[model samples]
Target: MRGLLFSSSKASSPSNSSTQSPARTPVSTPHHRTFSASIQEEDLLYAEQVIRRWDLDSPFYTKLDSLFTGDRREARQFVKSVKNLQSAMHFFVSESASSEKLIHAQKLMQVAIKRLEKEFYQILSANRDVLDSESVSNRSSRARSSVSNSDSDEDDRISTWGTSVSDGERATVSEMVMADLKSIADCMISSGYGKECARVYKILRKSIVDETIYNLGVKKYSLNQINKMDWETIEPKIKTWLHAEKIAVKSLFSGERILCDYVFSSSEKIRESCFSEICKERAVTLFEFPELVAKSKKSMERMFRSLDMYTAILEHWPEIEMIFSFKSTTAVCKQAVASYVKLGDAVRAMLTGFESTMQKETLKTPVHGGGIHPLTRYVMNYLVFLSGYSEAVSDILADGPLQVHSPLPESYFSSMTSDDSSSISGRFAWLVLVLLCKIDAGAELYKDVAQSHLFLVNNLNYVVSKVRNSKLRLLIGEDWVAKHEQKVKQYCWGKLSFKFNEAYRKHSTWIISDRKLRDEIKISLSRKISPAYRTLYERYRGYFQGVDSVVRYAPDDLGNYLSDLFHDAGASGSTHSSSSSRYLSRGR
Candidate 1:
């Protein structure tokens, strides 16, 4: 009786029984179609209800399957069909069907699952091709779009896309591809297709990681963060993305590649920004520097502070290069050079204005009290201080390791001194020379040529002495001091030869004439010309006797009258006792 019932059930369900016989077949044939058509529509509906109950009872399978396959719109339909067929087979056999019938239905359902798995593989293969073509199209379109823009705007538009599928859409497609592959692999493994499952798993794993890198690591994160990057702020985000816990677990190599490209591209943008800011600051500071220098001590200090701040930016170059792996260190150094050049120009202009002001002041009134003029002292002090820091200035100017050569061996005042013309030191030396020339021209403004020469001697002596005593000596060199000292002596000789000796020759005979008349001439000469004449005669007469002028006075008489030249108590023609004089008492 049981055998008859089983045979009758099999006859009624020809599609299920026929397909069950083909489960062991290596290749699908017409029986596979008969198996698909064997399940009654009513039984399939009941199976769907049963599958829904299983979904509720074992939520893990549903959730896991959803996680692995949710990206594909068709994947859910395929999974639903598989679950419905499985449910219908279980439902039909349990409803009073014989044990053989039950076994046949299970076999038929297993064949359907294998067929569905095969179809899933084909779906994944098709999706991969579509995604590949789409990614290639996206890259090519982006390249074309970037090329269409100007070079200046190209960097800004480097990642812009013209496609209807935006970055987010591409990400979605990638996710779909990865999820579909994963679902197919998981289905193959559960169905005992070990070899096929391993092959699919490999592809699925790679796809997941590659997709994550392209979608999350590269496209999504970098596009959002790159434009806002700066020297101080860019590294953290890059590190976070590269070392992300999720990314590290899934695709460390892809993360590294993404990091490299992101850093390289972002750093290029940052470099341009840094250079632009540096140039802008340079131009603005240079425009305002002359006025700042002329205002007060505070203004000069502010200018120095400004330059220091600007120069400090160069110090970050190493860190930037390290982070970004910049191709050329020279690019960073050039920015520093440009900044230093502008700063040097501002310093030169300020000094030039200062020299002009000093010249006008010197012409208005003679500097007195045997001291250097205030303006000259200030200029020399500042320049001396500046020269002392030549090494630091050179570093700032060159933006790299720099050797500050000692002052030229030749005279600083020489027309042709060998200097590293490309260096900051050379520029500084030229500025100093120009200032000295201005000082030389300023000396001519004094009303008395002898006084003018005296003024030059005083200032030049002060400069030479200051330079010799300080670090400025290293920059101006020993020869510079000696040359200026010799200049001082030459001016002193001029004062004596042209102003004093000449006056003495013209007045000496008058000094020895009738005592009353000689006395009157001597009094007039003392007020107008005698002090300078006396100063030169007392100190330099012996040296100049044969060379500068003939001996104009007998030694004893000249000495006696020199002592009386500045006397105020005696009348203009009165003869004074010679013994009262200091020079006359010591006469040879």
Candidate 2:
């Protein structure tokens, strides 16, 4: 495009308007007509040598096939001769418009371009291994020979990659061959045959790109087909896409961008158009896979996979933005963002559904011994697993509305900063609270008030333990754990005192309960009481002041007294009642 606009066809003429014409007539009306008349006076001396080398009957075409299979050193000379022909065409085009030399130059320009086209295809096909994007991009700046005037400002013709031979013989033969391709491409483009060069380039490069991606295991699928597939079937495809997306961005698309820019450096439009054409569909294929997966059936099991796809694209977003930055190829980027945003919405939707499911839990049976409930364990552990992708989860939650119901302890909501509502901590905390509230509503399943309170303790303790020990600790902070834990201890003390008073009052005069049964009850009660008793004694030691007997029993003494609890029917109940009353009154 930069060089004097030569004809697109082999037989270009001033009258042929088929080619894109320059703003100025290539054969400018000379300010001095005699200046043009003088053009024929001198350059004709080397016209024979200049045009004959590429006279269409030259030996180059017959031997072009041999470069792939045999001695290929002449390939460099072939490119040089083409460049020389381009220079001569520019030379004669600048001379008298009607000069016979200019006409001969046009004919030779066609012949030279024809031979160069054959060489271009042959070099590209033959050097397929040698001209890989990695090789081309890495070694390109070293091939510095220019195909046009150094000072040409057309298209800013300002480029780092040039179209000539490598700097020296030490250059790898592959680099030399790449140089040959660049040289041929530049000459063809400058000679107004860039369309022919680009046609062959796009077909071959697109195939290689498509093949590389397919070999990486990415298959093109219609959106309808993807939508019709079940998760069990499409899940693996999502995983395959996860792997393929990284490679395609880092190696496939980026490499093509570099290679296309390098090969067509002489013309920005050709390179932009070519690169866009070559990579747009392939990139759209990669990005569209995620969008399709996002649109497919979603469930709790598929949530993480969706996040995996979201994160896979999110992590590589900048590269995708840059690689497909061309206006013609922007759909690839748009598709990527669509998939990204859709996956995020899917995750939040799944999270909302997961929360709703907890609220709808079917398991209402109270654990007979006040141990952790099934809903508490399942939902808490689910949160622990979800916390591993904290960064992604945070981004997903960043836009989420606060889902915390007001009945949740205000401490849970107040501890959050303004931004924390959309952070992983807020989302995960909301989830845990949803489970906790569900448990609170189910407490009435137990007939005994003490057992119901104890059930709350068990489930809250389980939630606290999970958050304290796992990645959830980092997400939901220590303040949350400590607050919930204090509630656990408070419930525990109330449950213990209530049970002890009930047992003592119901059986004051009773005796001779089975020894084994007595021992099991004592052991169970011991588990609750001894540690709390010891802790209280240590914490409030001497608080009873001078009345030491009001505290009467140490933790060990209490355990010893428990052994005599079901003895002889006639044993004095008054003494036991007296001490228990004194202790309970003071403790209360």
Candidate 3:
């Protein structure tokens, strides 16, 4: 009766329609004519036959129902059957069929399945907690069983649920995830969260297997495609894609965290091997996650800090080499270097020492006095010099220069002319000039510049005080003390020396508050530059007047000082814009 109900309805619907709407004017015209509901009934009858033939009360149907209800046991079975169905669909989804009608039918089937999946997910979500707990318990139990029954076929059966999905189904799943990611990406773009969306995209990218999808999205549709997507229609799919991404990322972090804890907590070679393996795994596809690199670096730092609690690990493992290879390590090193360069001498020294200690250095060299880590130092200097050049050039280009001042002094005054002067002798004259020019050249020269500068000053003051204090100890006959009287005289005679607190305190006051000092500084710097700069209009002289095969400004050695200077300037900063600004300045 259920399958044949349409046979009786077809003969009865037309007569009832005409009589039922008597209050309305019925037209005999074809457009207004009523049709029998029998065709609709027949169509429903046909669909019910396929559905009922599958037997909704069967064990398979009950399992599917439980799957939709979030039972892990049932879900596993459901997935196996779904995988079989997907293999069957591959002839439709992935391969061209012989008949167009069959192709259309296949598409209808796919749509129906997707709709079913949507309904299933909705039911699962409504009972998410129950499903989540079941999934965790099931997963844990499976993991234990896998270890216990390594050779058993049951383990294979369980593993095959996700891993045994047909290639076609896996591809289809990837396609589905990609499609959903695209929708979420579009939503993100339209909602004015493009940057955050990009971050999320980076995190989700490696989860999807098809690189071709990303390539197509980026190259063909571009970011504009996101705005054109139907988010309301695709939102559930997006959530599924996001869920997959979360699962993948969480898995990666779990492995990373476990290894990190083991490597840091124990000195055992096996544990270190495990940790190294984990780090390598994280790095294997790291390029796909550019946005997560920043956060990962922070996480690694915390991880490394925990390692201190286990000193035996430090003694046994080559952690320095291992850590540096981590993406997080490089990022942290970059941040630390920036902080170090701008920090006060004391803090900078401390940080520098820490950095050096972390290194697996083969050679020993002094790192103080701007010579710390020749490669790093060179990078810093080049960047700073380039910045100064940029500032000088910008000033030159800004306006008509009617007046100019003298070059910077060859020798800066270490002592004040007046005894009561309240300034610091060490104004970081060269460094300050370099920094000012860098700032004027439109570079964010220092992130925490002021604080770092002050710290350096305090550190220098501390060192100088320590030296003075040691001098006082000489009066008490300490063997460690050098000849105090001669040392005092020599330091006093030195033009770089200050009259203790009097000279520096005065200079510090003036340098801190006086605008004229900056102007004077600018003037002094301009004047002290090479004489060639002042003679820009007239340069007719040749240096080979005596018939020697020589060049002007050429040194006996081959290296160009100016070129080296510029090269060093470029090394100070990583960003191209910042490096470019460095070369436009002259004095600094």
Candidate 4:
């Protein structure tokens, strides 16, 4: 019914290439000029049948539906027609460039490329659901595995298992769409229509990549825009970029690369060119958002988010490099590295600034009762949280080691340096030392030497407790905790007995005001200082004169008096006089 694709004597069947893949374009061979000169008629006759569909005056020209999309069976026919047409053109080039049939075939070739160009665009646009990034990525991964494990026939085997939604031979819909694209890309590139195919692919796929990143909340903000925004405005955007970067590197760019590779699998140069163009600009911009955020106002609070962004890129760099491996897409990898470095610099600057601020703090005012100081709370709280990011912080701080320029005791610095001053443990240990020193300075504000020691004990205990409870303990170690704990006990013995006596002397006339606070203080002092006070008291009992028998206030009684002193009603001396008389009578 149809003209033969080649003479039965010399030419092979065009359908032979048909089984290869839908991506196969019609290829031409060099034959004897005499063969093409004689057999050119068979080639033109077969090709003219396909040309008629686009032929202005031919009866078949009015077939309004595209030759490629109307009938699924026709997709193969379209590729075969282009191949047959190439045979005629080969005759013209090898035997006679001026052959009249060559002009007709050239026109037919243009029609074919034009037709394929339209179809390529259509399939890509219409199949957005089937070709979604995740699905396509999944297919690409499977296809890659199959090709690696099997012979070249894997392409043929998988294509047969087509992505078609229908059952039986109809499974070609899902994968068929990709195959259809490959076919169009092949036919176009082989016929020197590569520029047109690549241009169309680049524009449409580029937009999709751009739109996906946009939907993911990534944007190309100028430094002025980001720098002008406050942390509140910029913070949410950083979070969005953090989330989006993962999908972009893992699935978005990855899927796009996979899709591009499959569609143009036939031509390495064209595929790389197309894939690179599709992902480069948008991907580079997507990664650069973190850099912009890092360049914004550097502060202690924003540092962690910047590090989060940095850590994300650092973690995903391998995939980014793999997906954008093409030379054209190298910018994407470089931009991500740039973001990683810039965010790191921002993080270091913020941490150093925090330390410098801590160093500059002069403890001018003392906290009353030697309780926890704000400086102690603020610095310890910040360090406790900073220690939570041990891995990231350690990595960052490794680049810039801790520089201890403070007036710290040489022995302490020697101890840390002997261990590893630049290590995270030493780094945090140094921060703690700086905090304890500031707290020590604050202790001087207390008039009583005993209260000064108590101030140091309370604040250092808070610092140690914070370390013990959080990841700081692992970073700073138990030796640091035990050493400071011993320091707390030492302060508990410091003229603490004087505090008990002073409490009774200052407010002896007053009755206890807050019984709850009183018991709490009693329990704290008893747990810490009682046993030692009792030992000292029993040893020194014979030292007091005749009043030894009348000594109404025992070491056990001191806890009750000190607990009540802070929470007292302003009662007269008569109340204390009666209580002392009762104490004396009870003792006797």
Candidate 5:
């Protein structure tokens, strides 16, 4: 059963005029009015009662428990169900919250948002479908049609589906969605669910379409028609669709592994319907669909890790390359970590327990055939160690001291030493060392061995050499490298010099545009907490500061001197390498 929301008032009251005549009797003074208003509380218990009653026997509630249940398959089924229910729940709660019942409106919003995030656990679960379906679905619709249609489609049908809209049309749609989301967000904030509104709004802003017109590359688009569009009508449908999308995705993570597997076994159908036909433009970005497919795969794997089901996911890993790609899902992860931190030490402690159970010796075992093997055991272990103490991974890692691996048995490097083996030891060692340095800020902890310094220098050199070679090889290996090159390569230690150079050029603009963020970057860079991290921090900060300082502090002639500063930062590599090269340099 559903509940009815409060209706708007139709009647209007007389307005007060600045010049008051003696028609009205004298009332309480301003001081008395303030005192009375101070004690007021907006109650929503009645609305809450309605929400509770309507959602009591709802399948979403049942799915919620099942999604969290130990049975992975059941859990995923429940997640899917709950996701579908999320939109309905959001609307029901939001619509039902009377304006007068402010606190209750806020409470319902919080509840709905919590439910929205119920799929995080399932995101990492090892279902095969998670990885497989994404790539398979993204293929031509003819190839993907079995789940939705016959492979032999007529030419007219193809023409109808693939209507060629120019980039301008897509931009307009993106703008429409973005505008609608912003309006809904404003409404939510006004209604007392500011926090939830921000969360939902941020996700929509990032995942669907970036709201920044400059970033969206819609340079020529006109905002003149903004008033012409029916923002009111578009806003409600967009909100409804967004709620539906979140709920549907969340519900997919529920149910038993087998149940989710069976349900989404028809990935082709879902993708063809939701993606191929609807959001064809987005299908080009592998990161988007891959994550969703991975979620599906994870749902199934949560229940059937031992079965052949995970094989499909394993095979699809390359197609969904962000795991190793430079796309850097770090920002998303940072948000998650930040959210957890806000929950306090008790919640942090519980996460530690959960982490241990998820990785407790069993999931690490390798499968015989291809499957979703955990690639992050060491990282996860490190996270667990830190989680126990209630600390952020970045805080502990970013620009921290390097930690030494306890002496490994000689066998650890034996495979890599073999003729056929790739020398992955150095790369893995570099990764661990980088993480440690960032996590701990390396401090004065490993000053004796100078491991942090040496590690940075060597990796920086290696990455630089690679980038240079890649630039040279661009002609010959251009095709291969174009497909595989990581965007992060530019920020890697070797490229810090270049990044700094780039930042220095733009330093002044940032200061004028966003001064505070510039200051934070400067602090992070100047602190010497992390040499490698400093490159980015400094670039961001320096450009911000450099620009502002040049404008405010430097005269036109001195501007060249500031430009020289940018040049110096970019060229510091020679001096830096000369000093640090002694630690690990192989004698010429």
Candidate 6:
């Protein structure tokens, strides 16, 4: 009968005996019979009473678990229950319970706690979707509000949101999760499960941070899209939006370094948008200057104003670069340089066109009374005006470091010491040189050598005088004016030596037997050549005295002949002869 009962007891035991045994025992051990024999019925009853007590408390633990896992509830109840359960287990272990009973009760509590920890993690994982959805919905609502509101309303809304977020008037899903996790962690810490608590909190914190960064990225992308739109129509709106975002972010995260990065990135995008539009407008205006300048003086002024606007925009590049920590200052400066170069090209084209027009006019005008044509005066005046502003123009054009430094030849202009040919000052100097060369070339088109020399003298004198009288003297220098003045003197000398002296040599011996005919012929010759001869005599009076002895006319009577040089060719023959005789007696 005893063997049968023992066999029955073994049969009733669990098939997986290892799982049913204590955690410290091995599955292959043959101590089951001895272990069963050691447990008294009184110890079994006590173990049963402990387990019954736990079962009775299951409803409370289940309710606490539900409350802790529920959204929008404080975790105080769950924390208190965990503390109570740990206390109860300690109390039960300290009572007069047998060893087996105490061990069994400890194992039961440990199992319950482990299950609760597993449920806690599962709840955290399950709530992730809710947290994500809440974050997405909040972002969407803010975006919608921003889009629908006017500027004033938008400002107010942003201010309100910033205040609410700062003051914690509105709680995010992450905040709620963190609050619950902190409670759970505290309970676990008290129960000596600190490592598990740390692991859960680390994961939750990482997820919250990642979600925040993603949301911020989405907001930044939206602003970028708005920034890239048409600048003229949307620039104000974009600026206002950026300002609001800056305020919002600053208020929301006042001490966070991340806010600085976000603001800088958004500002960079705004600056890029403005820069791109400015560049495009500058290019279009530069290419269109030829037509615009032809329309009116106001059109040219407008073009310059546009250039100033582009320069103003470019000036902001340094501030933008510094704020954003950008590495593209060189590239931005290149854009500024390109715009100035285009401006230089436009000015060059206009000057070339003006030169062409002046050349045609100069070829038709005679160089007797005033020498220079009206067109020549206009061109010289314009060049002087341009040179006066050369310094200002150079400042506008030269924003970057000098790149080219080839030495200019000595013959070009020794006073111009700057070797940076890429600079605006260098370019302006080249333009002035080009215009001067054009004027010199135009002088060669005259039919007579004397007239050509006279033309050069008049133009060069005008340029030198204007430069001396204006700010251009500072740019071109006194030496440049002196050099051109020397050229004018050389031209005057050439006209005298070639035109006046040669004419005198050809007509020196024109004598007629008839006194009336002789006087008439001499009077005619005097009218044709006296002005140049008198000019030469006045210029080289004492120096050419020995040479003048070989000439037909005596020095005493030269001024009398010179005074009748411009008499009309169709004047009465008697009147011309009388006028010459009257000037000759006055000369004596």
Models 1 onward score TM values of: 0.34, 0.72, 0.21, 0.72, 0.16, 0.34
In terms of lDDT, which candidate is strongest? 4
Expressed as tens digits, the lDDT of each residue in 1-588 for candidate 5 is 121122222111124333455677457787975554343221233334434432434564654342222433332332223333333333434333445444444455445334433322222122223212222223323232322332121111211101233544533332222222222222233333334433432343233322221232222212233223354532343333334323222221111111212222233232122222212222222112222222221221122111111222233334323222222233322322332233223232333343344334333232222221232334434333332332232222222322322332343233233321212232233333333333233222343333433333333333323433532222113432232233223223224433433554465233222345544555554454344443544553442322222221112222231323212233432243333233223221
What is the lDDT ranking, best to worst?
Answer: 4, 2, 1, 6, 5, 3
Worst 10 residues of 2 by lDDT: 153-162
lDDT score for residue 547 of model 3 = 15
RMSD of each: 21.3, 8.1, 27.8, 10.9, 32.4, 20.3
Query: How far does residue 511 in candidate 4 sit from its true spot (Å)?
Result: 21
Residue-level lDDT of model 1, residues 1-588, one tens digit each, is 233345557755868666665667457467764564466455555444433432423444442243223333344444545545545544455354655545654554455444445544554454543344334233433333332333234222212111235565674454344334434433333334434434443354356445544454332323234334452343443333333322332233222222222212323433333223222222222223222222223224333433342333344334323322333333434443454455544444443444455444543456763346666687678767666556556665554322323343354555444646446656555545655665676676676776677777677766776777787777655666667766665666545345544554354333344566655765675566555556655664443233233333333444455545433344453354344243223422
Native-referenced Cα lDDT, model 2: 0.69
> What does candidate 2's lDDT look like per residue over 1-588, in tens digits?
334543333335545655655765356556655664455433443444544554457665355333223443344444455555556555555445566866766665676677678767876776666566555545544543433334222223222222333435223655556555666677688667899999999999989988888987887788789878877898888878888888788777877887777678788899899998888887887788777777777789988888889888889999899888888998988999998998988888888888778767865577877678877888887888888778887787776654655444556745678666555676787778778778887687888887788788778777888898899887778788777766665565545555765766576446655667766876887888789788866653442233233344557656654654665555453355555556555554
Q: Tell me the spans in candidate 5 whose CA falls farther than 4 Å from its real position.
A: 1-64, 67-102, 120-129, 132-588
Question: On residues 274-294, what C-alpha lDDT tens digit does candidate 4 reach at each position?
Answer: 888777888878988888888
RMSD of 4: 10.9
Error of 4 at 110 (Å): 2.0
Better of 1 and 5 by lDDT: 1
The lDDT, on a scale of 0 to 1, for candidate 5 is 0.30
Task: Report lDDT per candidate.
Answer: 0.45, 0.69, 0.30, 0.70, 0.30, 0.45
Score candidate 4 by lDDT.
0.70
> Which is better, 4 or 5, measured by TM-score?
4
Tens digits of per-residue lDDT, candidate 6, 1-588, equal 122224434544576454565886545444763454344333444434443433425554443334344332223423444455555444334333345644664565454456446545654565554334334234433333333333233222211111123223334543343334434444454565555544553355345434443444322223344334543534343334334323322322221112112111223433233223222222222223222222223223233333333343344444323322323223433444454455444444444445455434434445564366565576667766665555545654454323332344457656776554555545544545655665677676777776777677777667667767887777666777677666655565545444644553354333344556656766776666666566655764443334333333444455444433333444443354465555334422
- Count of backbone collisions within predicted model 2: 0
Clashing pairs in 1: none
